[model samples]
Target: MIRDLLHNKKRLSLPKGTGILFAMMFLMAPVQIVAQDTPRVTSKIDSTHIRIGEQVQFEISVEADTTTLVVFPEGQTFAPLEMVRASDIDTFRNKDRMNLIRTYALTQFDSGHYTLPRQKIIVNNKELYTDSLQVLVNDIAVDTTTQKMYDIKPLAEVSRNYSDWVRYLIWGIVFLAVAGALIYWFFLRKKPLTQEEKEALLPPFDRALLGLKQLEESRYLIQSQYKEYYSELTNIVRAYLEEEVHISAMESTTEELVAKLEMMQQAGKLNLEKDTITNFKSVLQKADLVKFARSRPDTHGAEEDRKVIENVVVRTKEAIPEPTEEELLQREEYIAEMARKKRKKKRITTIIIAAAVLVVALGGAVTYYGFTKVKDTVFGHPTRELLHGEWVNSEYGYPAIVLETPQVLKRTAIELPESLKQVISTNQTFTYGGLLGDFHISASVTTFREGVEFNMEDAIQGSVKTMEQQGAKNIIVKQDEFTTPSGKKGIKVHGSMDITLPGTEKSEKGEYIILNFNEKGAFQQVIIIHRQDDRYAKDIENRIVNSIDFKNQ
Candidate 1:
């Protein structure tokens, strides 16, 4: 009956309670499925309270399926609290599920109560949030009653390490070696000699004999190179005659050479036998025929011609006359002059090379180290010396002002006019250097009579007027409020000015800073002046300004 009614789309009546229960079961089923798929995110801190500047570790954890991508928060997401560091995300896996945890180190400098905002975590493109945390930062307690206070110590000098300069020294050595090699190769090294040069240096007769020996040992005869052999043989005898007899034998034809020899014999210049002359002429004509006319001579014939040529050279050398004493002396002087010229040339070359090397080394130094650094190192700068020198920390004047300076300040007597003595009780001054020097510092304290109120504006105007009276011109004035490290407030008057040197018309751009403070019925002033565009001077001024302190009476 129930199946027939349900199949026929008939409304089957049931108890009201049963109908409501069925409806509730269907709605809860979908909710359970979604709850199972959602990722879980939680956060906690190591401590709820910490001292100021103490670190707290805050961690966030997420559990999700392996296929889900989880991203944790980054950067300074915690306001009023600083993130000291962030650790890498750690992953733990269990079958198809994974857990990711990330830790952040957080701290706060000020003592206060703070709340860490909820951090956002993303899982599979869905946003998830962790719970907010509350933290309290407590200040550290100090027992100032029993603690003793000491004067601020002077700045300790830091010794520079010279190890860094070793690199420059090594580079200098490399450059010097390169320069030396170039000089030696171009100016000092000696080269080897060629075969022709070696022969030319020998005596003419000896050179001719050597050439004939070389020709005999050559392969020309074995290869049936008759033309080359005969040509070389004739050249040997021609070279000997040209050098020994001072004749143009190499350029002359065989007929011309023979005619010239006969003329010299007739003129009594050469005592030559007819047989020697005939043998030289016959060999030359045969060599010319072999060279120009393609005439071939047998190896035996060529060997005989070489023997004749050697004999002729010997006879010609014997016929030449010996040089006289005057000629020998003149030859010696010529050789001496040539040697002197060669030495002078070498000296000039050496000087030029040395200059170039010096220039290169200097340029390298200027390139590596700045020009200003090299210049200051070579020619000392006063301000640079003061900046690197030992410094002094001292107190000066009543209600004493404490500061550090490169040099000790000297006390100078201050004279108050009798007319103004009734209004001013005492004036004390301390100074270092002068207005026109590279750097100057002056501090003064002036006590007033009873019921005299000190005016800082008037004092600033007076100081500026006094500077102008002392040859400061084109002054530009600027004013600003300044507070010392000890919380002493004062007015800082500073500007640029043109200062004329004493007894000179030249002016230099200068910078000055005046700090004025009035305390305990006394007016105190600290003035600093330095040349403009001086980096070391600027550093000194900054150091002195920063070190100024007022001691409580």
Candidate 2:
């Protein structure tokens, strides 16, 4: 009976609600099929374990329809792991469907076990998540017991970089070229003479004659240029009268000039012939008419006027009296004074130009390299030279203080007074420069007599007091423990102060460092003093302090 009931499903009776559920299920079947066709996202890593600071590749793959838009994970979304780099999305297509794969380089600097959080991806407005991944970062292994130790390497000499100096050198060459050109133009160079200059060099009488001859050869009269012809003719005669007769003929009117010449003849200053003066006046009037009233003269009339002007010049030249001996000497003196003034003017001009070039060159250098560098380059800085110069490394004094310095320190005798002779045995000093100088370095070693204990604190105090005695005022003191490169420990006393040099009341800001060490009942001190703002001096102080070491007895 059960088998008949199972086989005869069409005959079996169903409830009313069950039929509605079946209809609902039949309608949702297509929706489920479409949901299954949605985009799929998956993620994987190349390795689950990596050394610290090492990179691991993480890949994300998405499968979607060609029409679907997909967005892969981006940025630092992976917690506990840093993304080093993200690669471009790679796509593979098969008919209507496509696969997109994006790779990310990830790294972790720390050693730990971490889980890469699930990454979010979007496809066609639907959100999807990739499965979380496990990662392990292991520390690099080291066995220090088997490793060998080595001494710290000494400072290697750094070759100076001349690339920056190349520009300065080019500027220097340009400046030299400009200076040479100016000097040659103002002083050494022989310039070709202009026409006017060549004319001025001739004597006044000869110059006027040359002008008349040149005008006679000119085309002014032939070209109906009557104004030019007459103008030149009159100028020649007027210039001759002015130079020979000592009258202002060129600037005076024709009437004023004739009147002056007649008065001079009456006074016996000039022995001019009345007929010569009359002819000179007539030629000047005709030239003025041609110039102002547009009066034209025939070529033959202009030629006759030129002849009269030439005759008048000759008569005026003959009438002029010879100068006395005193007058001749005065004229020579005047010419010499004028020549001196001309030379003085040239020298002044040359000096001004040279100074201008120097200022410009210095300004350019300061603008590019800075004022400090330019000043040091031109004038020289002692500290700067010592900073870059070859250094000396040697041991000094007993109980051997070994260090390096810019220059080898010279040994100096320190005489102890009779009062302290009983307490101190031997004191040796090596020094360069002094307290008042720009930079100073000194090393002193003093061995106390038997049964004496060296006290570092007392030594520091005594050193400060000594600086005060040497014109240092307003001193600030700071103390610290210092360790040398060779593992010797010492007391470092450093501070700033104002130093007044002897013979001058002005005080300059200064900085100082004093390093004191005690070994085998002997006290050793290294003292450095320099201008407060000297960077090179500070570097030198640092290098020397770092290089200090005690030699074994």
Candidate 3:
């Protein structure tokens, strides 16, 4: 009787709802038939068990017709086990069907037994589900009771490494090379002149005579420009004395020039006649009177004076003794040396100006973006992403230290002293972190009673003491005048300290600041503490300090 009832299922579905259910099942039969007909997917793992946090490989393979499109799972679709890495799909063809294989690196942090749920894979507008898998993540077993423990190794003494010395040596050699090249080019390098050089370096008497001829051609004496005439006359003679006779005649008065000539004559350097010296003195004195005293000379007198000046030049040349071989050689060497020095001086001036421009450009970049950024642009820094991340603008404390920061500052309760309570009628504090944290920020505002005198130095010292109580050791404090954005004068105190976190044995380097502002009876204070070497925190400290503004201002 039971077998007959089971075989009569078609007769049992005569109801209207049951007939609709059969029609719907018939319509979905093709999808089920397609999935059952082909072995499209298979999921497998290398091992069913693994040590916690150890990686395991999970593979999924598919075999399909050549014209099918397949898409694998991506992202955090696997919840119990994290996907460490996912491999690309590998495809191969065998006869009519295409085979594809994909691998995933998976790990689990916790020690537990987990099930990887069936994953959906799409192939040619059809959904195919993979088989469920089981993985057991077990903790590493250790027998501490039977194992012996060893003390930590002490710090080893280390000498300077060869690479460090080599780097320094390379830099030193480069510096010396640049300095030596500059010195040689500027001071010691010798450049000999060609035959044309001798022609260019005319003797003082020849130069002066040529100048006088040019002056005559100018015809200033005929034009009644006595001042111009006298000025040229004096310059020609003075230049001749400076170049040939080794006298600073251009920088001397008329009397001093004459005295120098007499001294040279007495020293046997020259054989100047008494009349020649007298004629030279008279021409110079008359020229000075015309140029400086505005005295005019008649044309005939000027013409006679010009002739006398020419004679004086001729006489002085005759008075100069013949140069010895040694003297001639020395003179040639001196001239060559002077020419070289002039060329080198010009080159050095250009180099200095270029170097200054480069330095100014580099300094401006560093000042705006900081040394870390500048270095990153050259060598690279690790914290560029964090330093330049999005920042938030917010207000904190009662009097309100309004500023922008990378993260919002949290409020903290601070205990007040009895004496402080009497002077500070109302105060509030908002903070974010502690001394040893990567970034710390705090702001405090206090309103004082009438006729209250707030000592800034005392308050700063007290703050340092408070930091010491809070586990800051080896504290070093420094103070400087601070001005707010609104131009109110204030005090800024900054320092470094060694901080030991509450649950850690190691000490960390820290930097901190205390900025105090007093306007009338209202006092605003801000404090910052952070890791010393964290560039992002230091940037935040500077940004906060510079952004402070007072309502009264």
Candidate 4:
């Protein structure tokens, strides 16, 4: 090949060292057969240019299977191009064997030539760059022949206000001076002390302030999270209680602690104050009502509870007076008395159990029980002129207050909240039982159909026969003067009830009585299905119930 080229008289010239170095390079270099590489696109521009304030689309495309999808960095964002949309992607394959392609579209408004820099694509496990692609466009062409642009609005009037910077500087200087004085007073004038002394300097009052400061950070109360707010408030007070009262309130239920404190007060032994404990108990009760029963207090109630907690905290911190010398001796005697009372209770309990055991040993006979015993679940007879509170019940569930014909709510003489009363003044007739008392005072207005009178005797008699006739699984009586569903205490009067009239269809049982007051006396009949407890439930029926005088009023 060299001889054939020399015959043609073609000669190449190189500097003396250059030729030797070139030869060396050619000899030492590795030979590579490079295929024409696919275009490595870094970005895709939808349009090269756009009029100012008018948008253009741009897209960035990469031509490799292995390449990072690029996004404009914080400082490198395109001012000319505003992004209308963005897409996220990772691995992609190309249909063409020569190139793998991916792109991001970008738009620019201001007309100019924008060049996307050399793009990187991974090939043969190495990044190779392709020459940048330049996009070219011209600014919007304006016709001078047409009327000159007429709508060029003038600039906004400049604001020529006086500078307040000097006033701000003076104010800042004053603030800095005051701050410096405060710092000096706080640090240099601060008492040098041991750790204990420093803590002591943070007196109880200052500690309380600190606690209040921390509490201010928690906005639970303002946010109406009363449960959490009360919980934290109570915790703080409970810690204080342990500090002041020498009792671990955290370990005790309110009921248990209150009872213990009450006993101390009644005996006049230890000085257990009331105002503080009462306030404490009130808050706890309100909290318990909210937490356990989901009973939300009204705004006033919540405020009152908060006030009570505050009072408890303040009052509890005051030191109690210790016993004088004479009082100490008196307390010793009082302790002896308490011991004697405990012994007495134990002895009484023992005597009763022993007597009962002895009677059982003698084989003493007892009479049959059910007919005479007061039924836990059922109401027996009806009466007129209830002397006090009465109870009403139904078979379905606990006895709620029964009123007659709840349908005509507007015409009712007695005002009652919906929960405690139901109307049962039925069109159907009721059998009568004799009245146990002289007068029947019914706030229950009879909305009976024309033929029906409020017949006490017939209604009671029919009720008994109905029960015997109907094979009822159970029946409940509505009672007043028992605890209510929401734990409010009040008297509730019933209108009518459902009776399983044996063998007959279920009838509206209405043998209700009116006491001079409500049924707190003998006429407070019960349903066989004893269900509800109304206000003051523990009050038992007795012979004295008959003495409750009846007035026609």
Best candidate, TM-score: 2
Q: Candidate 4: lDDT of 144?
A: 75
lDDT order of candidates, top first? 1, 2, 3, 4
> Considering summed lDDT, which 10 consecutive residues are worst modelled in model 4?
392-401
Output candidate 2 Cα RMSD: 18.3
Candidate 3 lDDT tens digits, 55-159? 888899998887778888888677678889999989989877888999989898778798887888888778888888998999988888999878988545555
Query: Which is superior by lDDT, 1 or 4?
Result: 1
TM-score of each: 0.53, 0.54, 0.36, 0.21
Clashes of each: 0, 0, 0, 75
Ranked candidates, highest TM-score first: 2, 1, 3, 4
Runs of candidate 2 with Cα error greater than 4 angstroms are: 1-185, 188-192, 266-274, 343-391, 412-429, 433-439, 444-477, 481-491, 497-510, 516-524, 531-536, 546-553
Q: Which ranges of candidate 1 are over 4 A from the true structure?
A: 1-186, 189-208, 220-278, 281-297, 301-305, 362-433, 438-459, 482-491, 501-506, 515-553
User: Model 3 clash pairs?
Assistant: none
**How does residue 307 of candidate 1 score in lDDT?**
90
lDDT for 67 in candidate 4 is 38
Model 2 Cα lDDT, one tens digit per residue, 278-303: 87788888889999999988888888
**Sliding window of 10 residues with minimal summed lDDT for model 3:** 380-389
Distance from true position, residue 550, model 3, in Å?
51
lDDT of 1 at 238: 84
Superposed on all Cα atoms, model 4 deviates from the true structure by an RMSD in Å of: 46.6
Error of 2 at 117 (Å): 57
Error of 2 at 468 (Å): 6.6
**Local accuracy of candidate 4 as per-residue lDDT tens digits, 1-553:** 3343334433464344555555566768898997544546554556655555554444444554333333322222443345455455444555433333334444544466766555445555556665555655467688978857677675355443323445547866785576556545554354668975765557454454445445546776568776776676666666656655557677888797677667755765445467777777878877776677777566556666666665665654543456599988997998899999987976676566555554553333223333322232124222211212233221111111232210111211334445323433321111122122211122222232233334444444544444445442333434445333334333333333344444566543323322212221112222212112221111222212222222211
